[model samples]
Target chain A: MRRNRVLAAVAAGLLLTGALTACSATGEGGPVTVKLLQFQEARADVVKDLIPEFEKAMAKKGRPVKVDLVTDILTDDQFRTKITQQFYSGTAPDVVDMGGSNVTGMAGAGYLLKLDTYLRTWDGWDEYYPSVKKGARQRDGSYYSVPHEASVQSLFYRKDVLQRLGIDTAQPRTWNELIARLKKVRAKTGEAPLVIPAGTAWGGGSWTEGLLPIVAGTGSTLYDEKSGKWKLRSKGLSATFDLYADLVEADLLPVRDLHNPNPWEPTKYEKFPQGTLPVAAQGSWGWKYDWGPEGAAPIKNSREKIGTWDYPALVPGTEPAPISGGGFGYSVNADAAHPDAAVELAKWLSSGKALARQLTAVGAVSPRAGLADTAPYSNEPSLLQAEGKLKSSIQPPLGDGEDRVSQAVQSATAKILAGEADGSQAADAFAEEAEQLLGSTRVAE
Target chain B: MTTVKNPAARPTRRRRERAALPLLLGPSVLLIAVFVIAPAAYGVYLGLTNTQLTGFAARDPQFVGLENFRNLLGSADFLESLGRTGEFVLWSAIIGQTVLGMLAALLLRQKWLRGKGLFGALMLLPMVVPEVVASLTWASVLSSESDGTFNRLLGLFGSGAAAPLQEYPMASVILINVWRGIAFAMIMFQAALEDVPDELIEASRMDGASALQVFRHITLPLIRGPVFLYLLLTTITTVGVFGLVYFLTQGGPGQDTEITSIYIFQSAFKYSQIGLGSAASVILLILLTILGMTYARLAKVEV
Candidate 1:
């Protein structure tokens, strides 16, 4: 009886230990794994450098989160497929980066967590601009994303080339002055004076960003909020189209020869940095990535020679026009295991201090309002110029009709450039398409 | 001996054997049903609906019923891609595999060739190279820049710049596919040739027939079945060519070399139009099915 009792006790102890181990393995307070997906390949290295810092910070807070960064070098569509598959399998990443248009569709699918409750109490929420906050919120006025960075479209000119043509580098405040300078530069250089990439989809969108500010400066809304429709046929838009056509017809802009499959390659950053192209219309981020310390060293001492200026108004007396605010942000997955941890990480990443550090490293504008003016980047002359210009920058209309309007503008510009359609025809076609896309109620005057 | 089993007992034994047979084959049958048939059926179902990946939870997918098919029919891009895929199948599988394979088989049959076994193995080097490696190698060889092997060779011949793919996108990819595929075709044909009866060829030669005449009359007829088999196999393989096109041009320089498989991939993954992409895939499948049936009937007669 004594020997049997001892044996029974040993068996019970083993069983208890096995049960305890199993229970402990699946319990809370254990390291929770999170996956992060991003688009930019260059940002992979930056994330790698920052993950240890994040982990260390979390350790101090007694939160044990193990983030598994899965850097996918895929196109926008490919990333969507992966995200969709994960959702189907019930194994989606805790956080993801999505384009502005994609967020609505994803949120509608219930794949994103509503962050309204968190946003209301978050201490650092006030750092973001009102426009940024408004843009990041869903239709129900619930916030879902944290804005990381913002970009503005600007004219990147080769100072040496402009100086060679006896054009002033001190900012041209009006469209007529800019055009006069472009003609002089063309006459002296015998090269395409203004570079625009029409073949690339993103490149095609550049026209809308470049022209929106000019139209807005002329006191015309690109899209009327009351009507919820785009105004391609408006007098302001027609003038913008005419100016674009005139530029192309006069050989001021190379639209015909520049219609190569990869138009952005020969004229933009690739050639601009190598001194093959004189001027390019590009985003502020492109300026940083293509010209900053992390980028290819500018043509020996060309850093001082390179200059940036805002899009000038159509007329002299119009509001100083600029296209503002285009960039990516982070949002937590609705099905994430650790929602709190994900939100914490997102908020930390979007904080003014963190954004400032990122800007110092990458030379991009922070989404936070005052960071551009007060951060370490404020001292840089070109950035300071961009900051000064940001006040006049006009935000692109946000709604279902935005993409259609933008595409119409691009297609119309392409037609005018190709000489298949004149400015008037292009403008008329654009108006019809925009009206059809935006519905009659939203049509701008 | 005189006593015989009852009919009911015999039938019961037969029934037991039938049940056991299923038990024996159950695992394999279940695997095929789960992995192959189920997914294929699911794909067909998905092809009929207008399902967007992002809006899956809130939005009920409308049964668009043939809208995807109609869209594909109207799309110039889709038609162009199908034509490109057909051209690829012709050049790569028909001309490259069949003709080159026959030539290799004939060469290997020569008694003058030393180390026949070793030579036979050497011929399969291209087949053994990984697809990714092969694609990268071909890409480097056909690179548009001066650094590429083909351009460098052209330079040696007194040319400045030569872009084979850019100039002839379809032909360039076909050439790469053919070069990579010839080894398998050669091996299959060589095996088929070895199986041809030596006596028949000897008899034809003895009747004062020339070497070419004997080969034409006897060897060709004898090898027809295998040749037909090879053609069918190669066609199926070539029709689904994606990796080469993807690593090479990505269906561009203005969609000059886009194929059906590449189109399906773009629609499904890149464009996020899963339903439309699935429909495109079904179209490709129907095309391949027709070809397969035709080949099967032709192969039966040839054999």
Candidate 2:
């Protein structure tokens, strides 16, 4: 009897251990736990709040799944490192926050699930803007992610400061005219006239925000789509560097603040709000998320106080437009256990109602086709203005080596800021670095 | 009678003991092999490949032996970072922290010194403060604005409005490191100083040796073993430091303080070139090994 009792005890213990392991491994006998990852706090909060609603809706649909919201407030670089490691280990969250430039690279690596099949059945697919679809789809014509929002780069200036200094509040039609206006501001007031992110301190922003649009305005492409090579030695790149050099030489740029560890904090939050930084190259989100009533540094009556300008043409007679860039969105991990359930959650997160909430919460423009015509978006004038600009917005060619290109551009701009190199020399350094990073075949002179 | 019958049993037990020795050490050997040797070997292999965090290489990294090393060796930025790292380790770790720590340790040993416990605790405060906190504190103090603590102090002397961090990025980082590291050196040297024989110091003093001479010839020579050990420890720790300087300058103000560690991080994560970073790490490992061997050789002297 005692021997039988010992045998029975061992059997029970083994069974318990096996059950626990299975439960932990696959959430067996419990809700199918789908993990959702997000980087930004505001967006994460919105998603976190929507988790319960998703759980209830899924239960009603007879496919119940619990979402575990994992929030990582990290810089772009850190986030990339984490997500890459997670996917490489096959332990990635079911849903991930995929940024614009990350879509092509991550999808190509087989980390993201091909969402073409899922989107074909998703009813909300028809509601996304054409640009949103284009942005979300990789070059192979497969959609790996769904669009969450869209943003456009522009010149944001303090209207009161410019008007007070007798500088024209009207948009400058060309780069030279823009320079003249900035110089006039400097002459009229000792305040730093403009801030264009430069150097390693500003990271990728030196290229994306400060230089890319102007390079486009000059009718040059960083990446030759047809040739499939990066244009590191282009005249447009040199001209942009020259413009940076000019700004440094003329003392019109806030070089000191630009080198701050968190350059944006001072330039966008403090100095600009205080009217000491008169103009800056920023994004549409800057209206509410940077300087408006709910921003990091709120400027009173910011909608009326701040004005926007299309980045001017780098050359004469070239039409200039704001550069449209992709905003953060959700993608399912290829290795996810319940791809169907994760897809359902992702679709719900980007539904019209969810998209509207995300836009208002994060101060982003809606990527939904007709959602901007109603309620929250329609009530905000700045959002309407940004939406209008979206019709003619130009998006630069982006792909695998964009990050490396951004780093190279940052290095070049750093040299310009430090007075160590002229425009031609900086451009040469940029070409050399780009060639070294991407190999000789990928870089074009 | 029983003892006499166990003659073969003794040899049997001896044989069994020999057989069990391997079993005893098997777990430890396996642990070391798995944890230390395996990772280091993998790191070396990774150093020889074109592994990246994303893009084509990330999925199917191809072996590109010595290419990363060659690229880094030829790169001006990498070379500059190496030079900066050398300067940082020398001034901040070897000299500044060591000298100040020695002084503090000597001061604490004085019989006339009051509140020795309080003084020692205060000196150790920086070591207890988390690295992030220390970095943030220094950043606030050395902020560019006039209201910053350090700038405010400068203002009282009528020489204000100075952005010390921007103007002296390397110096600022080194000083903050020294502040963080002094307590460690102090503790090591203090323990060594306590072990010094009183008879030796008394004998030297009776010979009419000056205070400085006694310290230089007696205390210094007596503490050489701990000094070497301390140097090795500090050197290794200081070389790997990331958060302290990263939070403060991030190797910025135009790469003024881009030490090797910062460069490695940028190359690996920011630039997504894991192989290049691994090559740099391999080089750093080799250099550290050489330094450790040299220190070990020197430390083998008789106390």
Best by lDDT: 2
Candidate with maximal DockQ: 2
Worst 10-residue lDDT window, candidate 2 chain B: B1-10
How many angstroms is residue B261 displaced in model 2 relative to the true structure, after the best TM-score fit?
1.3
* Alpha-carbon lDDT, every model: 0.69, 0.84
Clashes within 3 Å, all models in order? 4, 0
Per residue, candidate 2 scores C-alpha lDDT tens digits across B81-173 of 989999999999999999999999999988899999999999999999999999999999999988999889988999958887888899999
Query: Which regions of candidate 1 fall more than 4 Å away from where they truly are?
Result: A1-35, A38-42, A47-84, A97-105, A138-141, A165-269, A296-302, A309-321, A373-375, A398-445, B1-20, B55-59, B114-122, B202-217, B301-303
- Each candidate's TM vs. the true structure? 0.80, 0.91
* Model 2 misplacement above 4 A: A1-31, B1-28, B145-147, B155-161, B301-303
iRMSD, all candidates: 5.4, 1.8
**Pairs of residues at least 3 apart in sequence or in different chains that clash in candidate 1:** A227-A441, A227-A442, A228-A442, A229-A442
Q: Tens-digit lDDT track for model 1 on A1-445?
A: 9999999999999999998898777656676676777765655556656667777788788987777787877554356557767765677778876555456556656778898888889877876766566556655456667767666667778888677767788777876788888888777777667875442233324344455545655666665555444556667777777777777877887653344334554566456775546677766766556677565343545457677777766744564455664566777898887898888777776765566665555555666666655555665555555555555566665543344455456556666665766768878867865554333555655
lDDT of 1: 0.69
Cα-based lDDT at residue A228, candidate 1 = 44
Worst 10 residues of 1 chain A by lDDT: A199-208
Q: What's candidate 2's i-RMS value?
A: 1.8
